[model samples]
Target: MNQSAAFSPLHRLWHSRRFRGLVPPALLLVLWWLATTHEWVSPLVLVPFGQLYDAALDPQVFHSLAEGIASTFGRLLQGYGIGIGIGLALGVGMGLSKAFDRIMGPSFHAVRQVAILAWIPLLTAWFGTGDLCKIVFVAIAAAKPVVMGAFEGVRSTPAQLLEVGRVLGFSRLKMLRWVILPSSAPAIVTALQLSLIYSWFAAIGAEYVIGVMSGGIGSVVMGAQEHFRTDVVLLGVTLIAATGVAMNKGLRGLPDYLFRWRTRA
Candidate 1:
């Protein structure tokens, strides 16, 4: 057998998504273990798995982290709902009404151009460094993409489809339900995915910026950092990465699952 032929299966496996995905983390874990065992760096910087286990074993540490995650998730959901609700409504109006678009589009565009983080300070000042501030900031972060997604999606609906809806004597609401929304759903869905991810980012940022006194995963990390609890800090970092990744996977096709009717028309 030729050498290339003999190696083909192994080469293919190396490039496979599942294989590639597993390998980097496996390599990092191996490196982490090696570094810890050899004491390659200061223990204060890179905490060993033993210390991580010890931190996790502490009931106080474990519970605080858990509570923090729960609160963060709660705020994420609330703010996300408010943000997308208004964003979709406004986007639909703008898409359907030239006058509304003209009245609102410039301000919307101008506001979205500002970096999301820039709003944190103003939000914190206006709303106070509490759940209100955090939730509001997250809402702002979640709204922009959703607005654009829904706007473009609706605007891009083919003229033929609208004409068909008209020919069928569909009412405004029926036309929107059967023709406009279905046609624009893909873009809207993509925007939703983006909004969810950005909402999480905003949630964490707000927690960090507005003050952890309110309690959230950001608080967990910040509090641990203040005490120089490197092990707990490492644990918090791991949790953040895991949560973000889980969300990405969990909601990747969410619109398809939640709004199945949107695709059916």
Candidate 2:
């Protein structure tokens, strides 16, 4: 009975998603400790955990991190919402109307081929390196993936599904809400997930490049770099990476949840 009880807990832990996900981080922590302890790298490049911990405990550092995260998340959420909203509408129109597609699709494709960073100069020229510019840049980065995902998803909807919608006398709005969206739930979810990831990256990139001095997580890194604070830099980077991983994990099951009707049927 004791053996069975011990084995049961171990087996459950071994199979749990949280445990599986933690393995890589645990390994990384071990490696980081080994490297720092042995001075495998220059202290300037990688600081010891003790130093990192001390930096985190500092009141000023804590306040800066909190404010930085708040600023960054503010810009991220606003720009991301705007981007995905516009992108979804445009993509759906293109997929639903051949005339609209023919007119806009070519230009969109041509524009997409241009490197994202290349637009920074143009956008900066128009928006003038302020919050507006950073938000616009982040929006642009987020929109592309959403546009592509939504377009492809809608285009791929089965003809039979459309026929069923028509037979049921669904209006355009009804068809879209009931048949189109649900049919393309997986693709839409994928697009949204990718958009979120890209937006976070773009939010940081915009702050780093735009240099608006508005205070973001990117500013923390920039400040640390300017002052040669390796521990602070590591803290900022770890925070950014952790938030991104959490966002990705949180959205991983969305498609399954949204499309459960198919599974049940």
Candidate 3:
């Protein structure tokens, strides 16, 4: 083909959705290669992709990855379960009672503004560097989002529906079961997804700071830093990002599958 025909073919491919999805990553890799080649970043700081892949396949590398994944996921699940459970209960209470919302909301908001890292010193003192500390950190990270989501979901429930339930002589339990829970399901699920993601990041951060011999992914990142292995650091980072994406897919997929009716206006 002549230059014009070639240009047309390129345009068509560029406009294709699947091809478009690949372009940004392809461009980023190219940019990374060029940047590394030109010494735009120090070699110690930015390892080339080839080195990363090679190191990744080594048995030591595989072992570290496996250990890190297991440790991080374990702590995350523990904290996430506790945090979401408590948050949802508190949220329901706050949503139902104006007096409770008035009393608890300010304190809750104040605590939420404090970063999880800031709480590390006190938590470490109380819980030591054990699993409890890490679990607390994850819970702290996950709880706010869950509380906010659930609170909003419950509070924003339609007044008319609540009145209708009262007219039907529904007890408080029946009202919550029939009217509130179903109406709030989407928002609660959204909160769970957010809490889970926050918990994942929190577990890794806690591991990096407090964990020893636990073999969490965060610890792997820490080890990479200690050893000045930028290639391994990047690989750890890549794995975390990939895992987060996978978790998001699984969590969100269930709601989308089961509640297709909710999507309609």
Candidate 4:
């Protein structure tokens, strides 16, 4: 191949979505290194990238991080699972029945209007600094987006489709199964993705607020902060960011696989 031809594909690949997406973070990392190396910021405030990298590799730091991740993940799963169940049920109920909507919609909206973090004080007071409080907080954070997404999905179902189901002599249950659910599959998947993102943030925030004694990434960060271990804190932040990105990417794959027909259409 000619030199131009050989380079052309590489050039195009560099501009592709995945490669483009990496540029900003790469630049930020470069900037961070510059800032630390040149003392643009004090080493105490922003540890050198080299120090952070070294801390991450330390056996003691690695073990603590592994344990923290496992503990946080367990709580996140518990809370997020509960939230999804409750949100799906409420969303479906409100979407399907005017009476149910009238009864529950106002209350749901009212509760949702309050920020999830605002509940932390009350939860802390009620449940103490225990895992229960953190779990409940994560659940609340996860449920709101899910409930709204599911409700919107069901409500947006085409009337013609429902009529077709009726014409085919589908009972309410059958109509729900064949028409409502299939139609709402996209929204449900979107909700789950959003919920997953929210739950991670919530879980971390909850752990931070509850303190290191509670145990998790948040606790690790907080503990590091207490001792002014900026390297460890930055490391925790980096780990959280990387994990969130990986999780989002993983979840994004599911909808693509499940609804590949949409792309073909």
Best by TM-score: 1
**Rank order (by lDDT, best first):** 1, 4, 2, 3
* Model 2 lDDT on a 0 to 1 scale: 0.89
Runs of candidate 3 exceeding 4 Å displacement: 1-9, 16-21, 35-43, 211-213, 252-254, 263-265
Encode model 4's per-residue lDDT on 34-140: one tens digit a residue: 89888999877898867887998899998878888889999999999999999999999999999999999999999999988899889989998888988898899
Write candidate 1's Cα lDDT for 48-146 as tens digits.
Answer: 888899999999999999999999999999999999998999898899999999999999999989999898778877988989898889889899999
Tell me, what's the RMSD of every candidate? Answer: 2.5, 3.0, 2.8, 2.4
Scored against the true structure, residue 11 in model 1 reaches a CA lDDT of: 96
lDDT of 3 by residue, 111-180 (tens): 9899879999999999999888899889888888889988999998999999999999999999999999
Cα RMSD of predicted structure 1: 2.5
**Candidate 3 CA-lDDT value:** 0.87
TM-score of each model, paired residue for residue = 0.91, 0.87, 0.87, 0.90
Q: After best superposition, candidate 4 residue 166: deviation in angstroms?
A: 1.7
Model 4 scores what on Cα lDDT? 0.91
Model 2 residue 259 lDDT score: 79
**Model 3 lDDT at residue 171:** 99
lDDT of 2 by residue, 1-265 (tens): 9999989989999999989999998999999899999999898988899999999999998888888989999999999999999899888889888899999999989988988789899998999888898888888888898888888888899999999999999999999999888777688779989999989999998888888488899988898889999988898998998898898888888878877888999
